[model samples]
Target: MTSHWPQPPTFRAPIQPRQAGARNGRFELALSRHGARTHIGRQYVSYPFHMTRPFAFDVAIPSLLTVYQQSSSGGLYRDDRLDSRIDVGAGAAGHITTQAATVVHDCHGQPAHQTTEIVLEEGAFLALTPDPLVLFPGAACSSVIQARLAPGTVLLLSDAFALHDPEGRGRPFERLEAKVDIRDAGGRLLVRDNLEIGGAHLSSAGSPIGDWKVVSNFMLVGAPDRLPTADELAVLGRPERQVVGITLLPNGAGWGVRCLAADAIAARVIAEKLFVLAVSAAFGQQPAPRRK
Candidate 1:
């Protein structure tokens, strides 16, 4: 019998865009005043931002306003996978949104994972307002965001997810897990939200861990003395479609809002509206519009 040789260990990789220009396996978006220049794979993307002060330009490709889908997958964890990360430095202000909904096809055999990490420096403003992340049947994915903020900076962030049938029939059972950790410049955890949803944990006839159709977490960080008032709470807590709760932090780090909805779109829309209200309240004015 012939001897079998052991195979070498190989590092799992991120999904490459169908087009070109990508950096470090992700559609790298380095914060810039004139929006962000996207790197498809190795080549620099052609799209450029318009530019808005107080609000820097954002980078998303295949942008909804521009290109199509960025990458294609073979299946799931087996081969085809979509993964990305964005790094925002101090004094940067911008919003990162996807061109459209991010849909993950069912992996017949292997589960796929999509991950994003956004790191913000002091005095930075980030609004991650992309479309909902849709997971088809048999899609298994996990995402994480590690945000490091400065003393006087403001961070506006949210995460939304949904699961539907890959065959286009209707909704199917799926598992979506997400985690967000906001830490100070010193690497201390200021706030943490961990959400895990799946067949077992999701309530059907008698489950208890989760019973809502969709769930989301929205966070805003600013100076403590400049918090929202009772009137502001009345306006924010008044969503006709979903249940939302807003609470101020005792340590002055910021405020937290958690909402659960029956659909992902509703969750996203609420998150954006809440962000706008929270920012306006925190800054004493309408936040700057995102530039090119």
Candidate 2:
């Protein structure tokens, strides 16, 4: 006799590359759970370009399924066996980019937590530039990220978010907390960044975000020689209609850029310039055109 227990969900077919429509500049995948394990479903892409030879890597979605369900108390947990690790640059020269979007359907003021970990082997290059997270009104979320890079590895990571009120109501999100930690292969901490904001603070005139509806932080970690000169970085850090700043990472490892903008377009404009400048400075060539 076979005992009856709920079996984990399995992919019905082999994973395949998805072609994002011509209008959508970026590829996107919804988050879901397979049994007790959470998977981004099998979605991957490979591109050969002039940057550091040709390489390939998989993009994993890191959010939990509860986020999509209509529940009063949303829950979020990391599947250590799976969600905790992302591997990049397995063969030849490669680059991996991961994009994530957060959609809150009926959170009802429930709070959620998410954590992600990334590891890059020596000589591997990774760019984790997810689209801006859109937090609906009544959302209270916290996100944590940990990344470990080998000595010779290069990394470009970006995290950005925007608040939204779909019903045309003026209500703001409840709160948001974000933290990012970067370390070397030996577990030595290189940089730590944190952001916490509440609805009240967001309305304050002197708030750090000021009139900006979106905020973004971009960090590049690699050897000193891979970073741009101070003057070049300074010039790239300036953006009209937005507040932006750039600073070198500790111990000459790399640099970071922080920007605040009134809208998503403004933020992307600043990011595009910074990304191009960084790629040119580190790789000696412009990056392949990234879809909007």
Candidate 3:
């Protein structure tokens, strides 16, 4: 044995097999409308706005979502996954929904990543108000949203999150990385937001981007010429359990309303209120309620 070659590093297999949840996934939604248009501003500029038109798309399943995974028998496995993309074309309007909250299993050995892409054509409008994506105690994940808007399209975007312990007590952990990239028809970068939260970033002294509680962001685009005023924002009157901020984006001259809340419901409630106030002031028309 003394003269034998090295023992290939004791070749011991992993103490436990990787989790069976190691699966790839994708969900896609496309949009196109038949007929609809709304006038833009007092300058007499008019653009096609279809709030009720729906888009055309194909889904492998009957529902608006899809998933893949294998239950872990040993309870010590890692899952690798992705949430494909949602594409919207010019003159398309559609609503995409997930049957249940998207969950990222505990990353015993690897991290989970998801990406979302959205596109709008000239004179198009798209609203993303999907149900909140929930994360488990030990799970890890990241999501990204990229949108390309045509010359004069309007957009309403929002996101919400909530976390609790087994006893229903508010318990928050984990990290969140959110970024938004908006581009013009010529592919020019308009504005980008890079937001990160988790770990030591939860302290009150952390950068203004995040704190120890849940956070929500809502962006609304009106006619290229109309921008909401401070008086319009005052209509919100400060929501409970939230610190709200409002501003007009330098890019596309869009208006944005942001909030940090204690839970998902609170965040959504605050977001809806802002949506109503802004939509009315900007377009002089009330937006429809989001369908579950």
For every model shown, the clashing-pair count is 16, 3, 4
| TM-scores for all predictions | 0.66, 0.67, 0.66
Per-residue lDDT tens digits for candidate 3, residues 66-101, read: 111112222212445455454555554333433333
Better by lDDT, candidate 2 or 1: 2
Better by lDDT, candidate 3 or 2: 2
For candidate 1, lDDT tens digit of each residue in 77-133? Answer: 322334455555555554555555666555443445555666666555566765566
RMSD in Å for all candidates:
10.5, 14.7, 13.3
In candidate 2 the C-alpha lDDT for residue 26 amounts to 15
Clashing pairs in 3: 19-77, 31-55, 32-55, 32-92
Alpha carbon lDDT at 258, candidate 1? 69
Model 1's alpha-carbon lDDT is 0.52
